[model samples]
Target chain A: MTEKSAQRRPGGRTARNRENVLRATAEVLLHEGYEHLTVARVAAAAQVAETTVYRRWPSKAHLAADALSELARTDNPIPDTGTLEGDLRALLGQILALIERPEVRRVILTVVSLATDDDEVVAAKVAFWESRFVGAAAIVIRAVERGELAPESDPYELIEDLVAPTYFRLLVTGRPLDDRLVDRSVELALSRQGICAAPVPGRPASPSADD
Target chain B: MTEKSAQRRPGGRTARNRENVLRATAEVLLHEGYEHLTVARVAAAAQVAETTVYRRWPSKAHLAADALSELARTDNPIPDTGTLEGDLRALLGQILALIERPEVRRVILTVVSLATDDDEVVAAKVAFWESRFVGAAAIVIRAVERGELAPESDPYELIEDLVAPTYFRLLVTGRPLDDRLVDRSVELALSRQGICAAPVPGRPASPSADD
Candidate 1:
C-alpha cells in the first residue's frame, strides 16, 4: 500500500483520469454556463487529451451527468436540533442554499432538458432524487419514533412538499426564494400532515399526547 | 368595430405580423430547439423581412419572451365544479397536460434560462406568472365566498403550494406527476390552510355558520 504501489494498482489511473475530467467539466459549466462548454475546453482544463475525455464520456451530456452524480452523492446532512421543526428548516435551508447557487441553477436546467429527451438520463435523475429523499427521510423517521409525527407519515411526500415550492418558483413561476417562503413551506408541509398538533416544545403535556 | 373595419384598422397589420412571427418562433423552437433558433430562420418561416424581425425584437431571447407571453396569456380556465377539491384537480390537470407537451417543456426551459440572464426577460416572465396566478386565484376566491376556505386565505400561496411540487418533479427531480400526486397536493394545501373543516354539500348548518 505504498504510494508507488497504489499508483500502479489496477484501475487507479482510470479513476484518477475520471476525477480530473469531471472536475474540469464542473468548473467549465459553473464559470461559463452550458453553451460555452466544449470537449476541447474541458480537455484543456483537465490537462487530459481530447481522446481521453471521449474515451470516458461519449457526450457532453454524459459528462454533465457524471458531475451531477457526484453532486447527488454528497450526503444530505441531517441537522439534529431536537425537534422536527428545526430539523426540517435546516434540511430545507440546506437545499435552498444549494439551488440558490447560480452555477447549480444552470447545471440543473441542462439536466432537466436532458431528462426530457433521454430515458437513461431520466432514470439516473429519478434514482438520484430518490436517494436524496431517503437521506432526508431520516428527520421524519426520527420524529415519528419520538411520537411527534404520525406513524403513517410518508416521508417522501413530506420532503417533496417542503422542497417543491422552491423548485417551482425557481423554474416555473420565477418567484423569489426568500426566508418568508421557506417558513411558510415548512409550516404548510407540517400542518397539512397533522403534525402541527404536537405540543409546543417547552409546554407541559397532558397524559393524552393525541390531544 | 365590424370585421372589415377591424382588419383595416391602424394596428391590424401590426397585429397580423406579430402573430405570424410568434407562430414562426414557436415552430422553429419545437422543431429545432433553442440552438438552431435564429432570426433569419424565423423571418423566413414568418414570411417577413429579417429586418422586420429585428425591428420588433432586439434578440432571439426577446422573440422567445414574446412567444411565451402568448402562452401565458391563455387564461387558466378555472374549472367550476361545485367542490373546491374538484376545482383544484381540474386546474392541476390542466397544468399537468401543458407541461407534458414536449414543445411547451422546451419553450419553458428556454424561457427560464433567459429569465436568469436578461432583465427584460425577467420582467416579462414575472408579469406573465403574476397574471396566471391572478386567474387561478379566482378558484380560491370562489371557495372563500362559498364558505369553504377562510376569507383571509392568500390565493397565491395556496396555488403555489399545490403547483410547486408538480414543477419541481417535472424539471428538477424528474418524477411522475400523476393522479396520486395531484390528490396529495390538493389535500395538503387544503388541510394546511385549515380549510378542511367545511360541511358537506347537502349538510344543513346553523345560521351562525361556525359549527
Candidate 2:
C-alpha cells in the first residue's frame, strides 16, 4: 500500500477495504479467538498487506477494539417500557443476546483483557462505556425519577449491580448467557425480592465456606 | 544453584529474607506493574537464585497469584453482627482495604485479565472468590435459618448482588473501592426500601410501564 493509503482512503475503495479488513478480523477472532489473531491472517483474508493492517491498527488489541466499537454503534437500544421491570428485562435481554453471540463474546473478552493493561485501550474502552453504559444509565435514571426506583438509589451503582454480574459471569465462569439466566438476573435486580429475601429451598443454596 | 538448593530454603536463613522477596516484588509491581514483572529481578532483590524461584513457581503469574492468595488469606474474615447489612459491610470493607493496598490493586487487575483468557488462571481466581463471596453467602444462609432474611430469598443471588458489583468496580472502572460505595450497595441489595419501589419526588421519577 502507498503512504497516502495508510492515512486516508484512496477512494471509497479504501473505506470498503478497511471494512473488509475489520470484518475479517472479527471473523477470525470469533472463530479462532484472540490467541490466534494475527495481522497476517487478517491481511490475507481481507486481501490486503500485513503493513496495510498494521498501518491502520498498532496491535491486534487495537483492531479488536475498533471492531467492538463499530459493533456498538448499531447496538439495539433498550426499549422505553414505562415499568422498571419491563425496561430492565428488555435491557438485560438485549445484553444477554449480545453476550451470547459467539464472536461478540470473544471480542468482548478480548477487549476487556486489553482494557486491563493498556492505558490507551482502557481509555477507548471507557469512552465506549461512557456512551453505551451512560445510555443504559439514562433509562434507569428515568425510572428512578419517576418513582419506580427507591429515592436514595444511585443509578450508576444500580447499573453496576444489574449488569456487572453478567460481565463477571462472562469473564469468570464462561457461563451461558441464555434467556433464562438473563430473566432471572433481571428479575432479581429489579424486584429486590430475590436479593433481599432468605434462601430458596431448591435453588443453588448459600455458598458454604467450604466453597 | 543446585536443584536441591533451588527447591529448599537454605538452612535457617533470616525469615526476613522471604518477607523481603515478597515486599520487593510488590514494590517492583507498584513501580513497573505486573506486565513488567520478572522472576529474575524478583530473585535478585530477594537474594535468591532464579532457580529457587523457578522451583517454587513455574511462571511470573503463578508467583503473583501466590502472593495475592497469601495476601487475601492474611486479611481478616468478614465479621458477624447478626445482621446482613453489618456482615456485608464488614466483608466489603475488607475487600476495599485489599484493593487500596499500594500494589495489590494492579495485581488483581492483572489476575482478572489473565483469567479472561486462561482457564487455569480463572480457576485460581474462582478459588479466591470462593473464599470471599462463597463464605459471605454462608452468612446469608445462616441468617435465613435464623429468620433474619425474608423467607423466600435466594442466597446465591443475594450474595451475587452483594459481592458482584465490588468485583465489577475493581475490574471494570479501576475505581477505588470506598466504604460509601459498599454501604450503598449493601443497602440496596439487602433492603427493598430504595431499589424496587416506585420512584418518588426528589428521587428519580417512577417507571410508568407496569408489567
Candidate 3:
C-alpha cells in the first residue's frame, strides 16, 4: 500500500487498483457528472488514497477524460461484418446508442466545454479521438483488402464523414437521430469512396427513383 | 427612460437601446467570455439600466444565447450564388471563417454546455439553428428550381451533410480545418443530391485520376 511500491508495480494489486479507480471514475462521471467528480471523491469511491489518484491523474479534467475514453473503448467494439456497408451500419448504430444516453451526453458536452480552457483536457480529447479513429479505420482497411474500397482511400476522412452527422445531431442542431438519417449517412459515405451499397432486393435502385 | 415607456416603445430610442445592449453583450462574451458575462456588466457597458437587460432576457443563459444567436445572424449571410455548388462553397467559407474565431468557438461551446440544463437556452439554441437552416435552404431550393438537384432533395439534410464535418472537426476531434476538407465536404454533399461540380477546364474528371 506504500506510494513508492504502487508506482513501481504495474500488475497484480496495482492493476486491480487502476481498474477500480477507473470504474469509480466512470461511475462518478455518469451518475454525478463532471462538477461532482473530484479526485478525493473518486478515491473514496475506489477505496484508494487521495495520493494514489493524484499520483496517477494530475487533475479532475484528466480523470474525467480518461474515464470517458475508457468508456468509449469498452462500450463500442469494432464491427467485422462481412461487407463494408454492414460493418458501417453496425458501427454507426453502436455510436448512436452510446451517445444517446443522457449521462453520456452530459459528460461529452462538459468535456467539450472544459477542453475550451484546459490544455490537458484538449490533449486528452485529441488522444481519445485519435484512438477512436484508429480503431474505426480497421473497417476501411478491411474494405480495401477485400477490393471493396480504393486502397488510397483515407480512412480518417471516410470515418469522419460517416459519423459527423450523427454527432452533429447530438451536439449541434439538437435534432433527433433516426433510421433514415443513419441509412443515408452510410450510403453517402460509401458513395464518396465510389462504393455503393447494392439496392435492397425490392427497393428502387436510385434514391431519385422513389420520387 | 421610464421602464414602462421603454417597453412601450419599439422604435427610435428603444431600438437603439436594444442594438446597444446586444452589441455590448457580444463584446462582453467575446472579450471576457461566458463566465465573465453578466447583465450588470452588459448594462454598464451599454450605458443602460440593468432592468432594461433583465426585462428582455430573464437569465444569464438567455442573454448569452440571444447574444450569440444575434452574432450568428449579423455575421453570416445566406449565399445567393447562381449554382448550388457556388452557393454552398461560399456559404461554407463564411461559416468556416466565423466558427474559426477563438471567441466564437468559446461562446458556442459554452452555450452548448448551458443548453444541457437550461430550457431557455435550449429554446434559443433550437431557434438559432432553425433560422440558420432556413437561410441556408435557399441554396438548395434554388438548385432544385434550376434543375441542378432533384425536386425531392431535402434542404435540411443536404445542408446538414455539407456542414457537419466542419463542426465535427471544431467540436469533437479538435482537428484543424483546411481547404481540402471544405472542398471535399461541398463535393460530397452535392453528390448525395445527384449534383456534381464540374471540374475546372484543365483538371482531372474523376477524383481518383489525381492519384
Candidate 4:
C-alpha cells in the first residue's frame, strides 16, 4: 500500500498477486500470530490457489518475512530533520511506536522464534534488520558528511550501537522504552565523536590505541 | 552444584530433593528442549516421585526458572578487577562465552519462546533476567565507588546498556560476538562518564535539555 512494491519486480499479474497475497498474509499474521499462519489460509484469504502461494514462498517463514519486509520498506519513513540528533530521535520514536503495536510484536516474536533454528529465517531476520536500519544510518551519514562526527565513524556499526540496546531491552530485559531512553542512547553514541563531555578515569588523559 | 542452594531453603531432605529435581529439570531442558519437559519426566530422571516434583515446583516454567535463577546466583561471578573497563570486558566476555554454548542457547531460546504468550513464563523470564543482572550490577557499583562514574548513575541501567547489545546480536541480528565488540561496548559506555575523551561536536558544546 505504501508504493514501489508493485513496481519492485517485473511481470504485471504475478506482482499484483504477490502484493495481494502478502497483504492477506499480514492480516492473518496480525489476527492469528505466526503459529497458525499457513499457505492454504493465505491463499484462501487472497482468493488464489494454494499452488500460487507455494510457487512464490515455499514456507510460511518466507511468506511472512516477505510481507513484513514489503510493508516496512513501503511505509517506514526516513526522517530528515537536518540535525542528526533530531533525525535519530524521530527514528527511534517511530520504532518505539511500531514495537508497542500488538500485531507488530507478534510478527517480531514469531520471526525471532523462527530465527533461532531456521537458517532461512535467520537470513531473513538479518536482512530485515539491516534494511530497517537504513533510515537510522542515514542520520549518521549526514553527521559524518557535515563533519559533525569523526570521518572514521562507521555508519552501519554506529547505527547498530545506537539501536541495539533498544532491541535488547525490548526482547531480553523487558524494560520500558521512552524518549529519554532514546535521547540517552543517541547521547552515548555521540559521546564517542566528542560531541559531549567525556568523564575521567584513573589514568593519564590520552587513551591507548589498539588494533 | 554451586554451594548454598542446598542450605537456602527448608528441610534437609526436601532441599536435596529439590536440587536433584532441578538438576534433572536442567538435563531435560538441555537434552530435549522445553516441549518434552514435564514434571513426570524430571521426577523419573531424578529418581523422585512425580508428586514430589509437582509439590515443590508446580509448573515446568516455575521449576526451570528456579533452577536457572539459583545457578546464576551461585555461579555468576561478581568481577572486581580494579578498573571499570577491566570489569566490563571480563563480564561481556563471560556473557559472550555463555551465549555461544549450545545448552545455554537452547535454554534461553526456549524460555524466550514461552515468555511470548505465557504470563507466568513472562514473570519467570523477568525474574531470571533481574537476578542474572545482579553480578553485572556489582561491576557498575564498584566503578561508581572508585570515582570512575557519577554517584547518581544507575548501576542496573548502566549494566543493561552494556549487555543489551550482546543479547540483541545473539537473539536477533545473528551477528558474531567477539572481543572487538566487547571492547567497543566498554569504550562507548566509558565515554558516557567522560572516562574517555569526549569527541568534539561540530555545532555547540551544550546538548539541549528536554522535558
Question: What is the CAPRI rating of model 1's predicted complex?
Answer: acceptable
**What TM value does the first chain of each candidate achieve?**
0.70, 0.61, 0.82, 0.78
Strongest candidate by DockQ: 3
Using alpha carbons, what is the TM-score of model 3?
Answer: 0.83
Give the poorly placed runs of model 2, Cα more than 4 Å off. Answer: A1-63, A75-77, A80-83, A115-117, A137-155, A173-180, A191-211, B1-70, B114-125, B141-147, B151-155, B173-176, B192-211
State candidate 1's TM-score.
0.74
Clashing pairs in 1: none
Off by over 4 Å in 4: A1-8, A47-59, A195-211, B1-11, B47-58, B73-75, B197-211
By summed lDDT, the worst window of 10 consecutive residues in model 4 chain B runs over B202-211
Q: Write the per-residue lDDT of candidate 1 for residues B92-177, one digit (tens) a residue.
A: 88888887787777776666655367776676677667767787788888998898875556778888888888888777887778
- Candidate 3 regions exceeding 4 Å error are A1-11, A40-62, A195-211, B1-11, B38-63, B198-211
* lDDT digits (tens) for residues A1-211 of candidate 1: 3544454563666668778888888787777776777889888988889987886666776676666666655624777778888888888788788887877887776666553677656665666677677777788889898988888888888888888888788877778898767766777677776755333344322111222
Q: Candidate 4: what lDDT?
A: 0.72
lDDT scores for all predictions?
Answer: 0.73, 0.64, 0.80, 0.72
Over the stretch A1-211, how does candidate 3's per-residue lDDT look in tens digits? 6977857468987788888998999998898788888888889989999998888887777777777777888898889998999999999999889877888888888776675566877877887788788988899889977878765567788888799998888788888889987899898888776632223333344333222
For lDDT, the strongest prediction is 3
Each candidate's B-chain TM-score, in sequence, is: 0.72, 0.60, 0.85, 0.80
For every model in order, the fraction of real contacts preserved is: 0.56, 0.27, 0.55, 0.44
By DockQ thresholds, what CAPRI class is model 4?
acceptable
Q: What is the TM-score, restricted to chain A, for candidate 4?
A: 0.78
**Sliding window of 10 residues with minimal summed lDDT for model 4 chain A:** A202-211
Per-residue lDDT over A89-164 for candidate 2, one digit per residue giving the tens place of the 0 to 100 score: 6777777778767677766655555545567666656665666667777776777688777666656655666687
